[model samples]
Target chain A: NAGVTQTPKFRVLKTGQSMTLLCAQDMNHEYMYWYRQDPGMGLRLIHYSVGEGTTAKGEVPDGYNVSRLKKQNFLLGLESAAPSQTSVYFCASRLDRRVYNEQFFGPGTRLTVL
Target chain B: EDQVTQSPEALRLQEGESSSLNCSYTVSGLRGLFWYRQDPGKGPEFLFTLYSAGEEKEKERLKATLTKKESFLHITAPKPEDSATYLCAGRYNNNDMRFGAGTRLTVKP
Candidate 1:
């Protein structure tokens, strides 16, 4: 089912440049999340959507923005990229909170800000 | 604040050696704890989920056990194919999930 897929497996950006990462899922999940994984820091949530048209800040939401206009897609945008923003970003989706909590993760996008 | 911590950032084992990885969490209203295996440059693969204390799940040569405060992933007779970073996460407040830094395991033949 290609549970979840992310666009642009790898990218390099200059400081101040902006870009958006796209996440798509075909599982009809009701929850979507964006997280950054830094070495030794684990995965830190940047933003999440409980459902279409709803977005919320997470543990590390600064320097990132997100949108979930459709049920199957979630997007994470960087207004001004910085060296500190360079990391591996992952997208995940869950079927439902009450019914199941296991998250299905995408391959991940590796970003490098120069 | 919710936190999930794993011990022994890295480990090396010989073939047939058995070991256990640890995951401790501090989160209010814990809903579930999860285990995942991730190979380099790839996404995490779900392993097991523990919903409550005293729960245990097994897959192949790996076993996951959960308690009120922590979880353990025990691997038996490790092989090179089992080499990867193992991660654990705790879900709470329904939507909040916190992941550990992960424990990298290397099994050498």
Candidate 2:
């Protein structure tokens, strides 16, 4: 069902350059999240959407912005990329915010900023 | 601060060897514990979820057990296909989920 998919599997950006990452899910999930995984850091949430039009900041939301204008898509934007922003980003979705619901993750997008 | 830590950052075992990976967490209140398997260059895949102490779940050759402050993922008769990073997570009262650094397991044949 293409549970979740992210665009541009890999990307390289120069400092100050801006770009947006697209995330899509066909599972009709009620919750979606954006997280960055750095070596030895596991995954840290950048932002999340509880529903189609609601977005909220998470543990590590600085330097990133997000929009969930549609029910099936979530977008993460970097206004001015920096070397510290380089990492593997993942998008995940869950049927609901219930504790028992397991999150489904997309392949991930690797970004490198110089 | 909520935190999740996994022990034995990496492990290598023979194809038929059995072992357990540990996940220790500290949170205000526990809601759920999760286990995920991830391959190189890929996102994590869900494996099991345990809700409370004494709860246990099994899938194929893997079993996950939960306690008050920690969780354990037990692998039995592992195969090469089981080589990957195993992640553990904990959901707290505020719905914030914290993940561990993950245990990289390599099962050699």
Candidate 3:
């Protein structure tokens, strides 16, 4: 079902440059999340959406913004890239909070900001 | 604040050897504890989810057990193919899920 897919598997950016990473899921999940993974730091949530058009800040939402304009798609935008933002970003989705909390993750997009 | 911590930042084992990875969590109203295996350069793959203390789930050579404060992922007679980073996370009723740093497992064949 291509559970979840991410665009631009890899990208490089200079300080102050902006870009958006797109996440699409074919499973029709009602919840989607954006997370960044760094060495020895694990995965930290940046933002999440409970449904289309609804978004919430997560543990590490600074410097990033997100939008879920469609039920099957979630987008993460970097207003101005920073060196600290150079990490592997992952997208995840789940059916619902009550019935199934298992999140399906995308392959991840590796971002390098210099 | 809710948090999850894993022990033995990295582990190496010979083929056929058995070991366990630990994930300890501190969260209010724990709803579920999850286990995932991630390969190099790839996203995490779901393994198992423990809903309550004493809950156990198994898949192939891996078994996950949960307690009140921690969870254990037991690998039985592992193979090289089983080598990957193991991650655990905890979800509470009040907030989003929190993940541990993960334990990188390497199996030498």
Candidate 4:
């Protein structure tokens, strides 16, 4: 299984330009999440979905939007890319919300907003 | 606020050296603590999960132990292949998972 796969391994964006990072998981997970990792910082959740058609805000949801129209896909969109948004983005999925359930992560997408 | 802090920002050890990485966390309601290993230019890979205090889990040369307020990942006889940033995360009752800055370990032969 692919587990989780993210599109556009790397990208360079000009400020104010918009782009969407796509994430797909073949694990049939019930929970999917989008997180950003900045240098010297831990991963911060931007948005997540418990299931298809259900999206919720996360710790750093501002300036970002997400859609989970299908169970296997979660897309993160940056309406207007900013320098602050230049970071490594990761997508993860898990089978359930149980405390013991482990998350599987994708390779990650590196975004550089100049 | 929920937060996680990892110690010794970075560490370099000899091939046979043994060491432990610490992860301290605070959350309104603890659900679980997780450990992951991330290689350069790749995403984090799951290692273990501790659901409650006193719980322990192990994989190959790594062992994870959890306590009331912290978790420790013990690396035994680590090899160069084990070199990477180790991350710890805590899941709360609200379903939010907070991660630590991570401990970078470099095992040199």
Candidate 5:
């Protein structure tokens, strides 16, 4: 089974452009997260969903919106893409928020904002 | 503030050499520590999870140990394929995971 998958593996956009990155997981996890990794910066959480129909902001949720209408899908939307938003995005999911539960991750989507 | 710091930003070792990488973190309330291996441009792959001091987990050539303040990942007699960026993350019981910049390791044959 594909544990976790992210769409638009690679994309390039210009300032003021809008785009959405989709993340899907087949593990039936209750927690889903979006994170971005940049050089010299560790992965930082963007947004997260505890369960269907519930979304919460994380460390770096600015410049983005998230919707979790389905149990298996989490959407990350950028209303006005900027150079600072250019980074490799990763999707992660966990069965529970309990400590030590492994967080499965998707391959990742590399985005570049010009 | 929650934080995680990894040392030896980069490491190079011979095929048969062994070494350890350090991950020091200070969180609000320690819950768990995690280790992961990531290849270039790919998401991280889980390695081990340590929940308490003196707790250790091993897989093949890598071992992870955790203490209240820091964690260590020891690699023994690693192979070329073991080359990757090793990442460390930690969280409190609340599931607010924080990650370190990670250490890039290269095992030459």
Candidate 6:
């Protein structure tokens, strides 16, 4: 089972341009999360969803929005891309992400803002 | 502020050599400690999970141990396949999981 998958393995955007990242999971997970990793910085959560129709902001949510329309998909949107938004983005899923659930991560999407 | 830090940003060991990596963390509440192995340009792969102090888990050449304030990943006679960035993360009871910058390890022949 392709535990988790992300669309557009790589992307390049111009300042002010808008884009959305798609994350899909086939494990029927109860939780999904979006995080960004920058050089010298650890992965920081941008947003997360506990279930379909429920979304919450995480550690770093500025410049981003998320939607969980389907139980199998989570989308991260950038309204106006900036250089600061350029980083490697990762998506993760967990069957029960309540307290100590172990997360399964996708391959990751590398973004570059020019 | 919740934080996770890993020591010896990077380590190089001869094949068959043994070593250990350190991870220290601070959070509102500790629920679990996670260890992952990440190859360059790839996503992290889960290794072991320690739920509380005195908890330990082992896989092949890796053994993970947890304590109140820190965790250690011990590698015994590691092979080149063990060369990767080791990441330590913590999950709080509230479901907030934070990661460390990662300690890169290189097992040479």
**Which residue pairs in model 1 clash with each other?**
none
In candidate 6, position B41 carries an lDDT of 84
Q: Write the per-residue lDDT of candidate 3 for residues B1-109, one digit (tens) a residue.
A: 8889998899999999999999999956778899999999999999998988899999999999999899999999999999999999988763368899999999999
Q: For residue A99, give model 4's deviation from the true position in Å.
A: 1.7
lDDT of 3 by residue, A1-114 (tens): 888999989999999999999999999889999999999987999999999999999999999999999999999999999999999999999988773368999999999999
Error of 6 at B8 (Å): 1.1
For model 5, name the residue pairs that clash.
none
Of 3 and 4, the candidate ahead on DockQ is: 4
Error of 1 at A95 (Å): 0.6
Name model 2 segments beyond 4 Å from true. Answer: none
Model 6, position B79, has a per-residue lDDT of 96
Model number 1 iRMSD: 1.4
Q: What is the C-alpha RMSD of each candidate to the true structure, in Å?
A: 1.0, 1.0, 1.1, 1.1, 0.9, 1.1
Taking the candidates one at a time, how many backbone clashes does each contain?
A: 0, 0, 0, 0, 0, 0
| TM-score: model 6 vs. ground truth | 0.97
DockQ for all models, in order? 0.75, 0.76, 0.66, 0.79, 0.82, 0.73
Give the TM-scores of the predictions, in the order they appear.
0.97, 0.98, 0.97, 0.97, 0.98, 0.97
lDDT of 1 by residue, A31-102 (tens): 999999999988999999999999999999999999999999999999999999999999999987773468
Q: Ignoring the other chain, what TM-score does chain B have in each prediction?
A: 0.96, 0.95, 0.96, 0.95, 0.95, 0.95
Clashing pairs in 3: none
Candidate 5: tens digits of C-alpha lDDT, residues B1-109: 7899999899999998999999999956878898989999789999998888999999999999987788999999999999999999987656568999999999999
Stronger candidate by DockQ (4 vs 5)? 5
lDDT at position A30, candidate 5: 96
List candidate 1 stretches off by more than 4 Å: none
Q: Per-residue lDDT of B1-109 in model 2, one digit per residue for the tens?
A: 8899998899999999999999999845778899999999999999998987899999999999998888999999999999999999988853457889999999999
- Give lDDT tens digits, candidate 2, residues A1-114: 888999999999999999999999999998999999999887999999999999999999999999999999999999999999999999999988777898899999999999
Model 1 chain B worst lDDT run, 10 consecutive residues = B25-34
Identify the runs in model 5 with alpha carbons over 4 angstroms from their true place.
Answer: none
**lDDT digits (tens) for residues B1-109 of candidate 4:** 8889999899999998999999999945878898999999999998998877889888899999998888999999999999999999988854568999999999999
